[model samples]
Target: MTITVFTNARLLDLQGGTLTAPSAVLVEGDRISGIGATDGFPEGAKVIDLAGKTLMPGLIDCHFHVVAYSLDLWANAIAPDSLAGLRAAKVMSGLLDAGFTTIRDLGGADLGLVRGVEEGLIDGPDLVICGKGLSMTGGHTDLRQRTDVRPRCPWLAPRQHGRSG
Candidate 1:
């Protein structure tokens, strides 16, 4: 088994809700095996010096939007799902870069993005996705021109099917 030790890390103390003293953390594979003062590390373990920097658990973003690239809601609504899905993957990757290990996507993220992240094909946050966002009639996402028409799913607003409510 391969082991990596992160040294000089100021870890967060969950019990006290504070940053703990500089210490060592042992990681075996994907799991953290131990954390303590650097006294007894097994031989052949790779060591990384954190240089007294802070190290803690990755953050979770409760609300994330992987779609809607522009303020023009109608245009975004008309975009092909494949295009939106690709853009969502990029957004998820940006979230990961921002230290969000997990994200709850409010809308427009799909199973493909989740699978990509799981398969390591795309670098992205752990995606917790709601298939799509629905709005009420004349609600926030109803951005149709008077001459436009869209098919209304059961959950979609009346405006989507060209019915004003």
Candidate 2:
């Protein structure tokens, strides 16, 4: 297996709240085979100089809505499914690039996006999708204005709106 070494870096050890001095990390293939002050591991191993930078694990967002492309709920709710999926792909890639390695989607995401991420069709956060959220007219997910007519959205089904009676 191929090996790579990262040197001249400070390693963060959260177990004891410590920072190592100029440590080295040895990576074999896609996984880190060794860590902390490593040297002379193997011949022809690629070396990366961190220049005293800190290396840490990626972050995770516990809650997100990948399918909601617009702040205006009506805009997103009315968009075609294909269009919404495309927009989600872009947003998910940005989330991955921003170091969100894991995310839990609260609503408006399905297995299709999960499959895309797994197959590498799009670079994105590891999704823990909760499927579609239950919404009602005049509820949090409903975005209709006061002047809007009945049937806030066909997708959400306005008949499901809550009633005070």
- Best model number under lDDT: 2
| lDDT per model vs. reference | 0.83, 0.87
lDDT of 2 by residue, 120-156 (tens): 9988989999898878767868676768876534776
TM-score for model 2? 0.76
lDDT of 2 at 88: 97
RMSD of 1: 6.2
- Runs of candidate 2 with Cα error greater than 4 angstroms are 13-19, 135-137, 146-165
Candidate 1 weakest ten by summed lDDT: 154-163
- Cα-based lDDT at residue 84, candidate 2: 96
The C-alpha TM-scores of every prediction are 0.77, 0.76
Residue-wise C-alpha lDDT for candidate 1, range 1-165, written one tens digit per residue: 899999989988889998888899999988999999876788999999998899878899888677766777777789998787777677777878888999898877778888989999888889898977888767776676666666766675544556577
